[model samples]
Target chain A: MPDKTAPDAARRSQRSRQAICEAALSLVGETGYDKLTIEGIAARAGVGKQTIYRWWPSKGAVLLDAFTETMEAGEGTLPDTGDLATDLKAVLRATVDEFNDPAFQAPYRALYVAMVNDSEVSAGFTSKVMEPGTQAYVDRIRAAQDAGEVSEDIDPRLAAELILGPFAQRWLLRSQPLTHEFADSLVDMALTGLRPRNPRA
Target chain B: MPDKTAPDAARRSQRSRQAICEAALSLVGETGYDKLTIEGIAARAGVGKQTIYRWWPSKGAVLLDAFTETMEAGEGTLPDTGDLATDLKAVLRATVDEFNDPAFQAPYRALYVAMVNDSEVSAGFTSKVMEPGTQAYVDRIRAAQDAGEVSEDIDPRLAAELILGPFAQRWLLRSQPLTHEFADSLVDMALTGLRPRNPRA
Candidate 1:
């Protein structure tokens, strides 16, 4: 009886958390971030307002949690197949796919707007959201270095930025269409480089 | 006597234009963008409101013109030394310095915010400001390729993105301190790459 009842409670807790996150995400999209509130999320999620206050201190926290949840739910984690090129291409594809989806894009954008508008958000945005997400790439790059699949001279930290920088610019700044072809091209260029042409060749 | 009169007229026109750009840049910084007005700029510049109207279509246009003028005043243009490495480093250094300055930084940020907020601004922002800026790097990279300083297989357009993307990310997103050391490291990594280690080496 204890085993069955305990598992059921755990499942209920998970479902409530999911509903809260989803509610927070959609409300932010429809009404905008500044207008979002704990009461609204509670009403939409069908939970008590106390439930939200127990979980998150502010709307920003809930939204970021949801953002990370959305990324993970759709794409498990960035690939780590020991091959740097294959892993990077997989991650880039997943990222492009996420950005392309309207459901995900809305909350993602709201989170970014807050990050840019508020100094408090900006300071933590990199460490809390950006840095943790980049860790997957950095870890994979480090492993590749050990296997001699990547140059040891390249800083994993900066290398990850090099890999993502073009995509980020196109996605956010240029608002250019991101395709797999573009992703492949970025990986190829950064990995092999436009090595200075051989004078003789 | 005609030559003297014509020279005086041209000088007055040039002085008025200078005053207007300077006034526009400073006003946007202190008052913020949406609150900025043409009449305010005219008053600050000590010129008639019609003078501004004759030269620029909207406040947005005036802001952009002033933004570009500041860049030319300091750096002249993105460098194009015979060597790609030398040219790229020079351009990166200049860009970092411009973003680091408070006067240049303020309107520069407003332009970006507008690009994100308004579709019309977005379309022109990429073409007018971003494309022209990126073009300098592209042209230099193409020249380097012709001179055997850069590999032919590497697309000049993509290569230019690799060079500028890091700086853009750091400037816009990270809002981190911009430094020559960081710029030099970016150039070095993109140029040589963290290529897969030599199995024997």
Candidate 2:
């Protein structure tokens, strides 16, 4: 779909760009990220490699674009109803669902492979992709802290980590099955917690 | 060092094997894992690639062996004084130190790359290496649950994830500076509490 805000010429450009991203995603799903090439995406999309290079510098960048688009379509804005625990659980449950989806998982695995292999790609993914994605949690945690919902002694940054870190570990590391049960349990443990003595105090 | 428990002939073999493992670590550090080859390790260790191939099926396996050996030397055992909070903190803090160390980080990055690329390597690493390493935590979490230290409602597996997931996230994702303080905070948060209402009840 073209960006509706654009004029006809700009709409055509947007459509072409969207096609290129779709091609990137398709090929990555088919070939895995390591075998995926810019040439292949361009060929699939009926565009030149120069067309892709004109917008994105590397295959990793193109994949990152595709990931962000899919991500927006799936887990866009997190809820903020002033109930921090409920809100966090909802967002994390969505994440569990996303990681379970093959459309997201395969390409994501490829991105991780690319990130660890190339420092430049890693930096781009972190700055352009991850840092922005994390802001929602950071904002929510800060809000909770300010509202006295979360303890003032808690570091919002670390609090955010407590929520998302385990998600990343389970999903990215493939350490265990990503389940809604697991996600809810994380929120449950985080809120009520494991301490016999209320370790927070 | 040779495995002291081995007989004289086996002791000599162990010493030779240790040299090869050391060579694998040194080369992985110097050349990075991608460029590391069995032939290169053999040449450095003054053995044939057949020697490496004899004991381990792949370079990744050899690397895992080296990782396990190094890990045993560094941490020996997680302090298991039956105090879950203290024991978890100590283990996680050591992990922070391990990830921060160049020796572990380089090979671990290599292992992660290898795991993504090869199913066989992934299986071996996950089952043989990760599973065993994580069993300690799983056992401990179960023990805590049985002792009524942790809430009975909590899934020990999920609880284990909650404890180590953040540590893995900070270390593996390269999201933030992994520190002892961060490790302590995770344990503190897990034990003391996060929610005012105690979601578990």
Candidate 3:
């Protein structure tokens, strides 16, 4: 336990936690999740193994925390610029850019591999990453509904899925190249739809 | 290599291949992809390790072959019942049913986990599973276009992703409960779109 009277000690503890999380992220990227260990993280962070153990239960927990920290460091919500299509496209294009970046690929893939096999890890990811990210889109859709740009009949949750799911599918499967054009097409197809419009009822 | 003149030897080789694939699938279900090995599959299948080595270079290859065999045992095309929405819903519902089955959960998750981490495994999966499956939907969309049910201006490939991507995302992320209702909603959303229809030109 940290002493409440010692401000310097609390700051040192916070610094140690950040170092450990960063160490875990970089180590997983270098060695992959299968070989990452608490000892390696502690050694790299210049902290004791007991320090890691006191904070996180397992390596998966540490990685989850690391991923969460990265996400929180970004803007916490989806853009709501009044036009749903423009805002969603901008967000998705940025996501495509992130997915295409070599610097982020290894660590993200390692975390995803861990999430696939372990239910506990999967649940942690859902809570920390998926839920909040999805909620931001849902909020944007709701804002569109209020502005009369979107139909009231559309379920905001499902609308969020329609906007976000294609990107996740293409990225996870590596089935095709992820491009800005692809993001724009998803927004267009999702908004206007696949069926031709009839001007006359 | 089996003697071409010996029908009995050829039949025996076919049986051995089947046995090995089955063993690989069941072993992955029991112990997961991380713990699976060629030796374990050979032992479980009652074949020598040399037999497995002769046909496959690694455990990932063996699992890919196993998954391919499973997919081949089913009907090889998406349904084309003239109504694109109905047909897409039917296909997505069956996929959701397969995902929810306890019998299929372990082996499928193992294959997916392998796909995410290894580019070779992922490429095999794309060729063996993802591409063929997406092509089936694309063909049906084209059929719908010819029949005047869909817009010719719409990109068939992106339409397929819009149809299939939601199911893949929910299944992979476990973000929400995947239900038949969700499948139907996706079909509707992908068809009519999110914007309210304007009746007057």
Maximum-DockQ candidate: 3
Q: Which order, best to worst by DockQ?
A: 3, 2, 1
Considering only chain B, report the TM-score of model 3: 0.89
Per-residue C-alpha lDDT of model 1 across residues B1-201, encoded as one tens digit per residue: 356988898999999999999998899889765557899999999999999999887777787777777654333246665767777787788778878888777787667655554446667778768887887778778887888877878998888888788778777666457899788888988888777524465
Q: Provide the DockQ value for model 3.
A: 0.71
TM-score on 0 to 1 scale for chain A of candidate 1: 0.74
lDDT of 3 by residue, A28-115 (tens): 8888766788999999999999999998887878888887888744555887778999999999999999999866877788788878
Tell me how each candidate scores on DockQ against the true complex.
0.34, 0.44, 0.71
Candidate 1 stretches greater than 4 Å from native: A1-77, A197-201, B1-77, B196-201
Q: Using Cα atoms with residue i matched to residue i, what is each candidate's TM-score against the true structure?
A: 0.74, 0.78, 0.89
In candidate 2, which residue ranges exceed 4 Å CA deviation? A1-20, A38-58, A73-76, A197-201, B1-24, B31-62, B69-77, B145-148, B197-201
Error of 3 at A115 (Å): 1.0
Candidate 2 chain B: worst-modelled 10 consecutive residues by lDDT:
B71-80
**Higher-ranked by lDDT: 2 or 3:** 3
Model 3 lDDT tens row, B1-201: 866768888899899999999999898888876678889999999999999999988787888888888875455577777788889889888888999986687788888888887788889988888888888889889889888788878999999999888888888888789899999999999998888766332
Q: Which candidate tops lDDT? A: 3
